[model samples]
Target: MAHNQLDLLRQRRFLPYFFVQALGAFNDNVFRQAIIGLLGYLAVSPQDKTLYTNLAPAIFILPYFLFSATAGQIAEKLEKSKLIRITTAMEIAIMSMAAVGFVTQNMVVLLIALFATGLQSTLFGPVKYSILPSVLKPEELTGGNGLVEMGTSISILIGMIFGGLIFAVAGAQGPWVAGVAVILLAITGNLVSRAIPRVEAGAPDLRINWNPIPESLAIIRLARKQPAVRNSILGVSWFWFVGTVLTSNLPTYAEVNLGGTPTLYVFALALFSIGTGAGSMLCEKLSARTVEIGLVPLGAFGMSAFMIDLYFARSGAATAAGLTVAGFMQQPGSWRIVMDLVGIGLFAGFFVVPLFALIQSRTPRSELSRVIAGMNIQNSGFIVLAAVLGIALQRYLHWSIPQVFLALAIANVIVAIYIFTIVPEFLMRFLSWVLVRGLYRLKLHGIEKNVPDEGAALIVCNHVSYMDALILAASIPRPVRFVMYYKIFNIPVMSWIFRTAKAIPIAGAKEDPELMRRAFEEIDAALAEGEIVGIFPEGALTKDGEIAPFKSGVERILERRPVPVVPMALRNMWTSMWSRRDGRLRRMRVPRRFRAHVDVAAAEPLDGASVDAQTLEAKVRELRGDAA
Candidate 1:
């Protein structure tokens, strides 16, 4: 259990895998960019260069479409570390051919090798993501994913630079340099793969499907088994789509809009890539080491904001041509453009990492490899569509680069809204996160130790403030179906959040027996379905800054369900902004202890059949101590 993501890099479990994937990404980009550099080395016509540039991506992506299903099956059937070694070995063979293509300056050889590289990548894709869940705990998923994304992004940027520079820097020796570099990278990745510890097969007893089409469709169905997982896959594919459009337009965008040479295109890309890496690194800290999908909405809108700003920052051609990156920076509005590029990249990171973690954590381990495979296939489709759509917008519609960007920004908003609407959990979590983080600095004690990671359990916490549910929801890694009073459940805008979170609304027997019965039924059903149900037991927000007597509802539920009961206490929340200490229930008041230090403490699970309300209340009191 490494507390920090970087700490994983210091350990054998993660470092080897990280470098293996990073090296693969580096070599992949290096090989592709080297082919582009070859256009100059071979002195091809501009038309030929354009044709090669357009054809390379399609050639590379074709294998993902063709072999992802078979690849997924192979990944599931073999042990993870062994599969990785095999992929790295495949990479060495593929890169060896690519080296010949470079040395002989043969375009056809390079294209065939490029397709081989894609096939190798397609095979690696499932194991690349699926292995993470096996090696990392649920708490470590976000950080681990962040590190992977960071490594891949930075590696891609550096590889692009290194690959593109071989001809420019080495002059007559460019071919040899390109040839040697890719092979060495492949060898390095292979060496790193050897160090990744042995991991059990995702489905060791499973038989692989040799026919790709049926298996591909079957995996796609598997990927869509759960709505959240399905949408997560869609979200990842959408990320690729956005990235494809953005990256494809950068060359022209740089030359036409910024009036810069080829160097500026790389510079702009560097800014975006660096920003993405930085954002990826931040996910662990922002998410509190949880697979927090709340960041997805934050990332989504943040990307759109910067993209829209980018369009406004530069909507027309540059005043001059052939300006260097330095000269381009000297121009007015350049810094804004720089910030926009970085911002879009930063938010894009925020958007994608959580979704990946969600897909990994939520999907069952046995099927995860194939799920990842299905996602890769869909991602390839989205990338191809994005390239084609972007090209169509430019060539057929004659849209300027800025206009294309503007359309992308608008499209992003629509897509985001649609996804969030269909899967309100992403948005629900986002709103809860924002409300909790905005109001308090939370400290958790015994939560990881006491709370069950899976299966049904009743979470009994003290009713301290209006924000208690949000705080607890944000603090706990798993989703909890909070049981609240009908009034609070219908609290204007707060009602929507509660309903979306699937919080059960109850009333006192005297107030409405029907609602109370319905609430009990829902709670029983939820627990029966292996879901966490949270209840205050005191049945209302505490009017005084003291714990109230526990009600009999807890006893009744446990009597019926006989599930484990987790006693949790919200400490120091009595004095917080949303508490009733202001002499009213959620009254508007002047700031007092804003961003207050609030503690959520939990005790080990009590046997539901044995524990009484008074015992649970006393346990919660001990956890809370005198903090209230």
Candidate 2:
């Protein structure tokens, strides 16, 4: 039975870590919001309040610039479970100091405490993300990230509400309550951290570098060495940039453009956060539990579309007094504005979850923590850049917050185009995802366990239709190099996709001997490089919806390279649009089937030398059963 993502919360391996991270996030928000609330309602002068409020976010973010590199090294060098416990212990101490600051009502002490908390968060960032891959299965990466993001979003919202409500109702006693709450939360986080199963240090012998500047540069350079990882980091950072701009501008946007009160502002925040939480959960269902970057582009598109809609939804007239949340919702065109905010948040979830999973899945395990630290450094830079740009456009250029949003939407389009063009894999995956998901209902059996996660393996499947390679490619999680007949490989639209996927094209020896020789050479080199090379051993599509005679090519390939061969069978595709059931012309004339049920089954791998083409064909036939 397949367990839902929420079921992970009950398991010991994941639950403890989840609680620790969630409590930490909750504490951070509670303390930060309490401080902001204090400045807003209790400060002596408007000037003083403005100064502190302006400086607060900067103080918290500064540590990322100073300590992220060192933090990354520490996470890589130490066992994650021990490091988390230590970090949580430090959090308890920091919250104790914050409690003192709250009781004393000293701005200096409180600011210092806030800075200390930021440092604690900076140290925890790398471990929080890097440990997921270590603790969860590869198939669970997307679901796990969704759960984490949802938890964080909900924590932030709850903390914000608690901080504001406690301060409002308690008066002078508010800070005391706030202080005690955070302290208790911290202690609880530490207690939970103790239960986390110990994860082995990824790079125990790695030397620590105390110098932040040079080490930061080196870590980024290391991340950039892998193109996909580098692009994913950029995508993740860009999300932060856009998100910061939207969030930081919300209070003023609500006040000036929407004519909304504090309650309305909170309502707007809730919409965005809830939308993000919903979208994060939706990722597992949309991507079919795989880490699909195709959704990233889809997310980017929705983000820009709704952001533009939000810009247009802005009312030009300003009000001296803001409307209450209830009053604002009742106004004409207000629901559209709210929906736009929700849409942006929803798509933001789709954009970020997959990118994070991609980074975790692609980076070398030993360096994953450091790479995440590098990403944090870049994220901080982008956030700072966002603040600067937002200020310049609104203050210096005399642009309204709505105009800034418009500019941001445009910026998202440019960034998406640039990244997709540079890394065509993202676009290729999007096309493949659309083809498989839109056209067919796919079912898989034993593909995840039977196909080796790492090392060279030749995948041999019985071909039933022209879309066979695509169906197989989309069904399996890993990238595959398909060796298909040259005619089908060069099909007008799909040829580009095959080329982008780096599929190997070949012809029969009688037709093109050179191509056949080159194909064998390419297969040998691909297998040597520990890649998954897929081939249809029957050599061509079945004309009468039946398996063809096995060919000697499989035996020849095995003679050169003795690797495990995974046998896969595709069923229910023989009657599909791409199949040559009636004739090529007639099949093309027939309307394509939508959501046709297709089953793909893979038997356990067999040793290359022991399994002949005939035996492998029989196994595939058995897996297919009576299905044509």
Candidate 3:
């Protein structure tokens, strides 16, 4: 299995998916920009103009509310690669209609085409997510998703600028050109889909639900059946709600409050999308190929903080005159505005990627498409709500654009407060932050850079010391759930840390057969669903500082649910007091000038057919070079 995600993207399967999705994204923004630009230039009144632009998204997303459930069912029932082809074919038809609407200058036809395009996307949703698990190794999901996200956002920015500029340059012919481009893109996307290796139907007998309202509700109930799946979906939905509200209102704030032309509004959009792109890439780079939910809160915190600063930083309106994007950057106070937008976008990526990966990682493969359908349902609903709320703030409450920004920032606090109360794990992660703040943190090289940003992973390490768990836990940027020997689980004080980290304890055959059974079961369940499960293949901490003989437990776990096993080596860890043969074990009183210097060297995940304890141990030894 691939370690670095950048390497993964170079492959045919992933790149096609990436570009196809990006093309769809560009199509989305290009058409929307065309409509918004035309409305800006032709709408009779300013009031009607913003209403028309904001309202466009609601109408288009209406299909998500209408078809996500049915689409999800379709995805689960049919072959996904074929489903992608069908969706691309549908895009071609939709773009053709859009071209006619644009050429005839028919607003009603345009709206219909926009909604039609949304319908095509809604059908594509389930297959889009389901294909990741089907095509890429479990470890490749996070970074794969991250790259897709970055490319999509950049595509949006490029499309928007392209649409606006092209309309300026071509006027009446703009939409015709955009339509032909979209059709060509769709055809290319379909060809790419045809190249994807076959992924059979996940649930061939899955039933379809045609009605939107009840079907949408049922999808949520389906997700609710699994705790991790539900949390992941809820987290995913929350990100969308926050994102929709911010993105919907950004253009208005940029024009009215930031005191700039439409070009500046475009700049704000670009900056925010760019920031989100950075955050998405960061998730992969920081987590070392694991889906780390800890960063979710970190991202949320930055999002809220930056949003708040943005509102407060606004000097009400531009003092002297309007400024372009370049001029705005040069303005003394405007830099803060730009930075806040960038940070909010960046944090949004952090907030979004893991949540998505979490859903993929935690949800059962059988029902993954349905759960994704539920997530899309929530997203579409929330986007509608966000648009309504933003418009209502302006039209009903008579709030200025900046006032809406301030209110949304304040609302972030309330929303976070509610979600944390519901999910205490987010709050629990904060405790680690507090503890680490009082301690020194050791940095590892290419450790986070080497791992996939999403999906399920089984990490195997050589057992040497009791502190191995903590060393591995702290070293990986992601939240790792270690499967430790039962004896250590009951240790005083440390038990709480294990509980907080959600570590699972296991026992040997003679120690407790029943407990060992349960431990294996948990490991299987976690890996089968896509969560990370770390293990020490040596069975127990060595009596000597050297690596011990490999055991069969990890092999047993792999037998239950086959996945990639990434080997990691903790160098110099044996020299620490936690080493099995180091002078003292479990003695916290050892002298400490500073924390030990340990290097986490990662090896490519073992292929399932070739993976065994002996092979894995040898790889670990090679990674370490000399004995620790």
User: Which pairs of residues clash in candidate 3, taking residues 3 or more apart in a chain or in different chains?
Assistant: 142-453, 142-454, 143-453, 288-448, 288-451, 289-451, 289-452
lDDT tens digits, residue span 304-357, model 2: 999999988873644445798888887888899999999999999999999998
lDDT of 3 at 402: 67
lDDT of 3 by residue, 200-239 (tens): 8989987776777888888879978866567667767777
- CA-RMSD of model 1: 1.8
List clashing residue pairs in candidate 2: none
Candidate 3's C-alpha runs over 4 A off are 40-51, 395-403, 424-467, 470-494, 504-569, 575-625
Regions of candidate 1 where Cα sits further than 4 Å from its true position? 584-588
Question: Which ranges in model 2 have alpha carbons more than 4 Å from their true place?
Answer: 318-321, 584-586, 589-593
lDDT of 1: 0.92
The CA lDDT of each predicted structure is: 0.92, 0.88, 0.75
